[model samples]
Target chain A: QQQVKQSPQSLIVQKGGISIINCAYENTAFDYFPWYQQFPGKGPALLIAIRPDVSEKKEGRFTISFNKSAKQFSLHIMDSQPGDSATYFCAASHRSNDYKLSFGAGTTVTVRA
Target chain B: GAGVSQSPSNKVTEKGKDVELRCDPISGHTALYWYRQSLGQGLEFLIYFQGNSAPDKSGLPSDRFSAERTGGSVSTLTIQRTQQEDSAVYLCASTLWGGEAFFGQGTRLTVV
Candidate 1:
């Protein structure tokens, strides 16, 4: 069963625009949420992460907005650039469970120059 | 090494054959993980190894899939009687107990 769910399997945006991806989960045990960026034929890399303790976390132009009670989280890319075109995955895990990660289906983002 | 290294970045195998994929984790990393990604699909957890404790094999699809970590550093994922459905990219990752996970490039396996 898929523990985490993501929307917009694919999206296209003009450069300098905002790109957003949303994810939700039903497992309350999950406390750590992270986003990953992957290029073609390459493994996914960590982009940003957030804990339920915080409502939002931002790194550079990337931001993660989390809602603990709603069990929802979203990634927002500000001024999306062509280089940001890639697959993004949202994952959840809890520290007590040996950090066993549960991932959502990926979203492929395309930024047109 | 600076990061996790996986051997034989690509592998082509015949159905019914057995294949082994290797992963070298960064030194001192106590947590290791194996995940599989099919074309245009999400990653599927395979297995996990942490320190000297027993590995978690609950994610393995079947008995045909098994993995072993030697000296808690290098891990080998073996698939027996490869099937066409077994073809996928096998990715490895290593991390500290509570730190970020660093992933390898992954081994793309094609079972013909």
Candidate 2:
């Protein structure tokens, strides 16, 4: 069973526009949601994360909007740029443990300049 | 400080052979994790080690896949009797307090 599901296998957005990626989880035990950005031939890097207590968390131009009741979370990138073109992965884990992340199938995003 | 480092960045082996992939986590980090990524697939958890305690091996795909951490610093993942289906990019990550994980460049394994 896929504990987390992500939408839009691929997305194309114009530069300076908003880019959104959504993820849903079936495990209520999950409390930490994190998004990772991966470029070709490199490892995934942590982008932004949110906890269940917060409905929204923003850092610079990146934001994570979470809905506990809906068991869903989304990543919003403001002023998307061509440099933002990469694969994004959404993952979730519990806080009590060592935070073993369960990942979703990645979404490839292309920000056209 | 340097981030996580994985050795043998790329390995190509014939079927039925054995291969060992190594990871050096960040200094002073107590948590280490291993994950595998296949083409067009999500990251699949393989194992985790915390300090000197017992590791979480539930995610290991089979007995052919095993890992060991020595001195709570470095780890090695061994794959025995490798098969074509075993080809994938193996990733290693480390965290200070299990919050945000820093990943290595990953080792690409190709089995023919």
Candidate 3:
């Protein structure tokens, strides 16, 4: 029962291009959404997060666009670089619901130079 | 010491045997989570512990899976009568409310 759904099992992008990954959920109670990045042999780390109150949030080359009505969200990587190659996972959680995060199947991004 | 730590980076056990995995969270982190990372399953939430309150075990796959945290610190995940399907990389993460979570390297478990 994966609450969050993610797309593009894997993608290959040219250097300096933009890589976009989309995610959707059915739980309206979810108020928080976060993206995690992981490299081989390492654990996933929090890359960015956004709350439903805000439509979007940007941190450096990463931006999160959230759509409350559609119960959808997306992560956009600007100027995709080789270093950005990793597995990206989208997760949803609500503060009132014990903060148990529901994760989507990951998307592996490969930025080729 | 500085980050979340998990033991026995790798483990292999016979089917029907029991195995225990350990996690030592960062100092003072109240939220601890256990997730299973399989080849295609991404990360599957297994259990959660928040401070001294009762652990949330809704995500546990079956009755053979159980966990407990001692003194609000170290935690352990135990699998009894292990089956081949139970083999997966077990990851542990720790975080505070509204903060970023820190994850360990994960223990790769193989039930033969």
Q: Each model: TM-score of chain B?
A: 0.99, 0.98, 0.98
The residue-by-residue lDDT of candidate 2 on B1-112, one tens digit each, is: 4999999999999999999999999999999999999999999999999998999999999999999999999999999999999999999999976568999999999999
Candidate 3 regions with alpha-carbon error over 4 angstroms: none
For model 1, how does the per-residue alpha-carbon lDDT over B20-67 read when each residue is reduced to its tens digit? 999999999999999999988888899999999999998999999999
Q: Could you tell which candidate, 1 or 3, scores higher by TM-score? A: 1
Docking quality tier of candidate 1? Answer: medium
Q: Candidate order by DockQ, highest to lowest?
A: 2, 1, 3
Deviation of model 3 at A52, angstroms? 0.6
CA lDDT, candidate 1, residue B101: 85
- TM-scores, all candidates, are 0.99, 0.98, 0.97
**TM-score, model 2 to reference:** 0.98
Per-residue C-alpha lDDT of model 2 across residues A1-113, encoded as one tens digit per residue: 78999988999999999999999999999989999999999999999999899999999989999999999999999999999999999999996657999999999999998
DockQ of each: 0.79, 0.88, 0.74
Order the numbered candidates by TM-score, best leading. Answer: 1, 2, 3
Q: What's the true lDDT of residue A77 in model 1?
A: 99
Q: After superposition, how far is residue B44 of candidate 2 from its true place, in Å?
A: 0.3
What stretches of model 1 exceed 4 Å from their correct place? none
- Stretches off by above 4 angstroms in model 2 are none
Docking quality tier of model 3: medium
